[model samples]
Target: MSADTADGDGSEEAVADEETAADDAAADTYTVAVDRDACDGVFACLVRDDRFREDDDGLAGFDPETADALERSEASVQATFTDDRLEDARAAAAACPFDAITVETQ
Candidate 1:
């Protein structure tokens, strides 16, 4: 009557755990980037994704409070997020007039 008994060798539970772990990992890893050189202060990305905000230089940047990691340089800014919001980031990238935004799945 144990849980393992329902699956003989407990392989069912192990398979389920592995699938869940893979799903979690896939759901929680993505990166969003902004090419500062191409950005034109349009703020289109901000409207599509709240995580994107206006930085001091009037370009797209990530909100430190929400982004898991933020990196910046003179030419670009990149943010890593551990959340199920890849579509939101994609929308932001699509909305950019200058094609400055990019989103990649990890």
Candidate 2:
């Protein structure tokens, strides 16, 4: 009933909310892919998502440190992630001038 007790209750609720958010983020999964044949090394995706980086061949690739699973081939690169950054991946896909980037929820 006191102001101090109310503040304590609010703080506990805030922590619980944060934990729920983290759990939701961990449950979400998605995949991002880059078509090597279509990509022109414009780096447009890099600006929207730090997870997208330039590879040794001067094309778009995924940052291994950020990706939960990464696969690279002669024609494309794909990365799977389980996090709350799906919108960031979508933004990068939408920013690609060559339509080389793709993001899919999994």
Candidate 3:
């Protein structure tokens, strides 16, 4: 039989097919980039994750260069895989009243 056709056994092949379909629909990587130029320093994202912080002036304060480096080497806000609800990420992205947080999938 072909991959597109399923047997009545509901066996490993069926599971594999479903898994493949899910993988196909899923994105390989995710990126959360803050457009600091447009950032209003809203701390909503900071409140959600300590990785985000504000400057002494109470504006969005995380170091982009540092964050970019960390994200590339270690912890990545974008590449993080979450079976948990994407609520936090989505909230962080939306919390930017200034539209600074941009989340993209690839």
Candidate 4:
């Protein structure tokens, strides 16, 4: 997915960044999910956003105060934000090398 920014002549073009591509493809509908079972307790996602935190068991979990506790067995919707934070959210997904995090958009 790529975006087309208008130039002097007003033409469309494609961008290379996947994060921006995803955002451009789906502007309003997007969410991020994390699989607790698949989470390796790595703190990479936590560092990237306020959405994730270390649970009592030292595993990656949603920040209790900032987020509602999501289901652990499946893809848990962690956080929702405006377009400005979309890139940061995408970075969080990428930070999880274990592939426990997933981003949903239409």
The lDDT leader among the candidates is 2
Q: What TM-score does prediction 1 earn?
A: 0.75
- lDDT comparing candidate 4 with the true structure: 0.66
- Candidate 4 lDDT, 1-106, residue by residue in tens: 4555465542333443665777665544456677777888878998897777787777777755543234453434465433445566689889898988887654
> Cα deviation in Å at residue 19, candidate 1?
12
Q: Candidate 3 lDDT, tens digit per residue, 48-103?
A: 65556665545554445433332422222233332232445567777777777766
Q: Could you give the C-alpha RMSD of every candidate to the true structure, in order shown? A: 4.6, 4.3, 8.2, 8.5
Give residue 48's lDDT in candidate 1 (0 to 100).
Answer: 88
- Kindly indicate the candidate among 1 and 3 with the higher TM-score: 1
Question: How many pairs of residues collide in each model?
Answer: 0, 0, 2, 0
Candidates in order, TM-scores: namely: 0.75, 0.76, 0.47, 0.57
lDDT of 2 by residue, 6-102 (tens): 4545888988899988777665688999999999999989999998999999999988999999999999999999888888888999999999998
Candidate 2 local distance difference test against the native: 0.91
Candidate 1 local lDDT, 1-106, one digit each (tens): 4564654778789989999997777576888999999999999898989988899988889899998889999999999998888889999999898999888887
Ranking by lDDT: 2, 1, 4, 3
- The all-Cα superposition gives candidate 2 an RMSD in Å to the true structure of 4.3
Model 2 weakest 10-residue run by lDDT: 1-10
- For model 4, the superposed segments whose C-alpha errors exceed 4 Å read 1-29, 64-83
lDDT of model number 3: 0.56
Which portions of model 1 miss their true places by more than 4 Å?
A: 1-26
Error of 3 at 68 (Å): 6.8
